[model samples]
Target: MKFLGSLYRFSSSWVGTICIVLFIILFVAQAFVIPSGSMRVTLLEGDFLFVKKFSYGIPTPHIPFIEVPVAPDSDGDGHLFQGKRPQRGDIVVFRYPKDEKIHYVKRNFAVGGDEVIFDLDNFYLRPNEGDEFIEQNYDKSDIVILNGQKYVKEPYKFKGINYNPHFRNAMRASMLGNLERKSLAMRPIMVAESEKVYEYGSVKFNAFYIKVPQDEFFMIGDNRNNSGDSRYWGTVPYRLIVGKPWFTYFSIDPDKKIRWERIGRFIDTLQSDESLIYEQK
Candidate 1:
């Protein structure tokens, strides 16, 4: 009877210790999860990734057993740890600016002092000189086909207001049924421009001409037309960058089949040319 009591006490102590260690790791070391497909191709819908917390420094410590209402400082302003500056093309996970409780992930595109512009399906990055846009091609196959014909789908620039041909067609088809000739003649007028624009696909507008301040980054998803990124919410502050994803630990399809081939895949750096991988495949 004495031996049994001793064994139970030992087990209880070990379990408590394990729980405390796990809490610390999750709080200060790493966090793992299956993120939304907002970063598809680069990060899949059901893919699991590990986010390193310490790559950047830790924030100000709140009083033990009591949550502090003040904003935590990750910069060296007076914090215990000072984070490194984020670089372009680095995949980072951070607290959403609109709602700090929500977490988001995106690839860094531009840093502070950079000017950005989008014209005719291209992205331009300008620092001091005029806008230098980069051409991006969206695969037409990703578009939904209707009636066995190539619908002139319009790629959406932002949300709420339909900018692409596909959205107009969908709205027309839904309202008038089968897109009649009469309905096509009365198509809605497209606004020339607006004072402020949503990031890409959402209806929220904060400001225009995002003059990225020091220690700030502009992030976007690889899936341009389908992603809600810096184009939507504004730039993310550098202190929010959790860390770069290192590897794909697990992947599973909705059908319950484990994706064995993707289990050990290494996440490519932002500067890595995606064309090379596509070519190899």
Candidate 2:
């Protein structure tokens, strides 16, 4: 009772309440609003969600809005605590690799030592020794045994992953090259360093094969066709990862109609729709 009373009294005070809220936002959980349509159908433009800050680790506390650093990085890894790093299939909320102040939410498609290939308008991933997992879990049709290695097609079975039907069964050009990241992935002339390239017949042309370096992750949006993801940008360092989104506390459409069904729904729950389940075979 005494501890409770003390906490209550502290929180009732202006400075104490502000500090408590800052502590929650910094170390525990933080409210994040979806600001773009990149993750549409799964997380919408107006969806309101809370980021589980401790999901990865406790980042260096920053003052709200102003974003001024409040403390020194203890481990020199941008986190106060080192926790589990991101893995494949995790929906990650992260600082934009290009701009740390900007936050972005994308599905972690590939992690370190993984080879990601975007070819022929299809997404293919060669996990580091991923063949064993594919052989065990994926349908044979979805697993392509190519050049004595295994590749999985669209391993993430999220229903929100939408592709125009016409875009499928189509030949697409692909180009990828070295990542020159200083503070972030530096972008110059993309074609200058592209050694591996393929030509295809279509206005829709995208090609590249890049290896996710150690301590980096590849992110892609659920709205594949409309999103600007690692395809256009570059891989994200684990230090840049902030947390995982927990749930939708509120959601509204462009017209401002409340999406009653989405309120209080878990992100994983929204993704686990049976209709979204994919065998691809």
Give me the candidate number with maximum TM-score.
Answer: 2
Task: Assess each prediction's global lDDT (C-alpha) against the native.
Answer: 0.51, 0.74
Tens-digit lDDT string for candidate 1 (69-124) = 24546443423567676665567777677765556777776788665543324344
Worst 10 residues of 2 by lDDT: 171-180
Worst 10 residues of 1 by lDDT: 183-192
lDDT (tens digit, per residue) of candidate 2 on 188-210: 22222224444333222234566
Instruction: Assess the local accuracy of residue 52 in candidate 1 as a C-alpha lDDT between 0 and 100.
Output: 64
Clashes of each: 7, 2
- TM-score quality measure for candidate 1: 0.57
Full-model lDDT, candidate 1? 0.51
lDDT of 2: 0.74
Model 1 pairs in collision: 124-133, 154-164, 154-165, 154-166, 158-200, 199-231, 199-232
